[model samples]
Target: ARDGILVVRPDSGELPKIVLDVLESLAGKFGTSNTPTGHKLLPPKIRVIQGDGIDINSLEMILKTMTAAGWAADNLAFGSGGALLQKLHRDTQKCAFKCSYAVVNGEGVDVVKDPITDPGKKSKKGRLSLEKNADGTWSTITEGKGDPAKDQLVRIFLNGDLTVDEKFQTIRDRSNVGL
Candidate 1:
């Protein structure tokens, strides 16, 4: 007969005021709805997962303190372990791939590293060019002095070849276009 909705995770405390005191003690013991954007929502059998200290700034401060106390971000349901994948690495977001332009004997070289004890690990020298401005914003253009007909960069490897394969939903619909 197990119907459904009985979530209630909670895993430890202080998570944005204990997830609004466990969603106001589960909406005062099972009961609540009012949402045409007014918020509140908590009773369809009972929910509220939260999974302890989740990240992204404590899940946007617990959905902005549960929508400023009125509630309903669909009444809670978030879970993250090791802050969504064990504290990541590669400088945890400063990421790195370096190698800005190189050719060697045929001469093209611009490559840079710039380290005197980390100038924010500076590295960017030539051949980069991204460009998509005119207010829409997106400028890279380092050394190789940009503008290869307003390059939007699309080569996807060449020598060992795989020159553009794409199709992971066409690179997630080109990374969700303007979203």
Candidate 2:
């Protein structure tokens, strides 16, 4: 009846139903109360974390279900298992890798389109490079100006030939990104 902490993790089953079921189970065991905002609050000593079958929609649905049932949002946590990003297609973010700028007929040209139907579909123009701002955040700039030697972007290939290829693991390690 005495301990440091207790965290119940449920990683299997359909998310929307399972999450609510777990919340009800916890309430039945550890009990719950109404918050000042009139939402059900779980006992602070215990909490639940769900880690599977979660996407943006599912996450939103879970939270909505919890709130509808009077459960506080703090009663549970979610782990996406990288699905949040991995499951996304380029179109989900409105990303199109078309050549926004290119050299044509020995002349520099800025190419872009601002569709009247969807203004958000407008793309950038001219050559682009990421530059570090004075506040340490990155901003995309057209027509590169920073010193080529110091900037972080590296050239790996040119002219349809692999110039600086590395193993997949090496690339992941070098970029410090995990998937």
Candidate 3:
């Protein structure tokens, strides 16, 4: 029990689970998973533990991962909300929304609202708030629901629904900042 930072067992085999736990707890912090085996790459994966009641940033990371993996992702407006999605990856490819957001949700993430601007005659009224679902579907939770996540999906589902994905994409493709 006394070898300083490097202690060796003097007798019998050791239970490895203790060692594994320590590593995983730390790994979970830096965009990785804490599997029983050890730290694992968790890119493009989603893990929501409502049981433990974790915060949104972590949940958002998982959602971001899912989107990057080309999977449908939705975060109920009441769900994961804090994000700073860069027009493009800070390290990898750059990304930017094609439209001028009345509100910037977080980095690449878009938390769109209905009635982008008052219809002139009014100040602000009758806006819709759309929520993204894990199934890659969207439903209005409020008056403004033009979330980036819904762009392509609504085209096929709602038919009459118009999305701003391309408009935002165009801005991203051109702007010095994918604003």
Candidate 4:
């Protein structure tokens, strides 16, 4: 689940008892601490690994074991989302984006995707909203418009898992500079 991936094969590696110990410890602190949470334990998406490229055969074995334990081996449900996120970090640079805002009386929350105009001009501790246009193009909200002064938020649905560089890019913060 960390490095390359543990495929849904019948021969995933032994899973190493150490990994199990870590999972168990994590389970005790979060959620029900059940096997499911253990299985989903991730080392803070920012963590890094060595040269442990995943092997198809080894992944198969792990999947088999997970299945025997009554847990679905589906990628989306189990480790797929995180794996996909990791791949994105390894491949490109993007982060999930979210912006929240509130509208004043007689006005609506101004949502904007254009960093320079909306988020850039405003403070850096909130969310942004994306408005759906008739033509489908996104517009950065400046002044309160549209809805009647309601709070709205927006965030990019990044892949989730991200590499160091990808994480930096995904943030899309002021440090990046120049929008």
Candidate 5:
């Protein structure tokens, strides 16, 4: 037991209440010390992991309850597995990819999907290109008016051939430019 901390995971029961109860029980058995914030900290040998039914809302509630009960946030950790991804669907963010523009017979054709039943589902029309403005912000140019030379969207594939093959780390670094 001295080699590592023992993580006690409570998988069932009401999260906020159960977490507080477990902390209280652990404090009674293994004891605790007070933090600078006047919150109780579990001994170095033990901690609690609350993994079930965990979502943003429940996590916030549990933290608030623990803080109110004089327990430090360090006494507990969280695991968000199914609650992190299982509850999500495409409609959650209103995300979809449709053919906005296509070229056939050497002519540009604009394709749009705007269902009268759901105006929010309206899609963009005409050829689209991403442009970085002078303010360092990005905007999509529509109706095929964007200058192809300045477009940030690189053609990665063309006619069964790979055009631009970029390393994953390069793309990740580019995505983190402003942040």
Candidate 6:
């Protein structure tokens, strides 16, 4: 790093221990300095990227441990894989689908799941559409409300047939990170 080459990776073992050991070792060898906020920072060319066995809690714990060890948060970078795939924000929220609205005997019924004891079970009523507002932020417009023409929801399947298809690269390019 002193010569401006950065190539460090930590893939196995206990994440926090490995990260702490590597950082301390680097600091001892190349030295460190305190940032304006008093966080210890290592030389710019040398750093560690923890890639394996990384979960949300482990990531937070690693950062906290780094902070407690007087190391700056920027000294480490993270790669996402099984940890991200297995533990996602959607899983934490316990997301589920319920019939929030239905047409019974030609009568529109606003159905909602609300338990008297658990407010967390409460859900929106009517239909939903993901649309982008004029301000350029995407939002879930409920109650069968939204400009049908500009709706972001794509009709990928219809009547037991897949209507929309694209190459893997095309799909990947359409992700949020792509734009």
In candidate 3, how many Å is residue 64 off?
Answer: 0.5
| Residues 33-123 of candidate 1: C-alpha lDDT, one tens digit per residue | 8988778898777888886557788898889888887888887788776656786645557667888887888888888887544577687
Ranking by TM-score: 5, 2, 6, 1, 4, 3
Error of 4 at 17 (Å): 3.7
Which candidate wins on TM-score?
A: 5
**Candidate 4 C-alpha lDDT tens digits along 1-179:** 45554322211223532223333344355422124544443323221121122345435655565445433333212233334335333213434444545456856564534433234333323333345455745444544444423323333344464333446556667345443
For residues 70-153, write the lDDT of model 5, one tens digit per residue.
899999999876666687644468677888977889887989887544677788888789899888898889745887777998
Per-candidate TM equals: 0.27, 0.46, 0.15, 0.23, 0.48, 0.45
Tens-digit lDDT string for candidate 6 (1-179): 14665857753456698888888888899899889989988888888899766778889999999998888999999887655666554325656667676778988898987754357657777777778777777787884567777778786866579998889898777785525
C-alpha local distance difference test of each model: 0.78, 0.74, 0.34, 0.38, 0.84, 0.77
Residue 2 lDDT (model 6): 48
Candidate achieving the largest lDDT: 5
Off-target runs (Cα >4 Å) in candidate 5 are: 88-179
lDDT of 4: 0.38
Global Cα lDDT for candidate 1: 0.78
When 1 and 2 are scored with lDDT, the better candidate is 1
Among residues 3 or more apart in sequence or in different chains, the pairs in candidate 2 whose N, CA or C atoms overlap within 3 Å are 40-70
Per-residue accuracy of model 3 over 100-179 as CA lDDT, tens digit each = 22333543333432322223212222334456567755464433446655533233223357454566667577655323
Q: Output the TM-score of candidate 3.
A: 0.15
Give the Cα error of residue 93 in candidate 5, in Å. Answer: 26
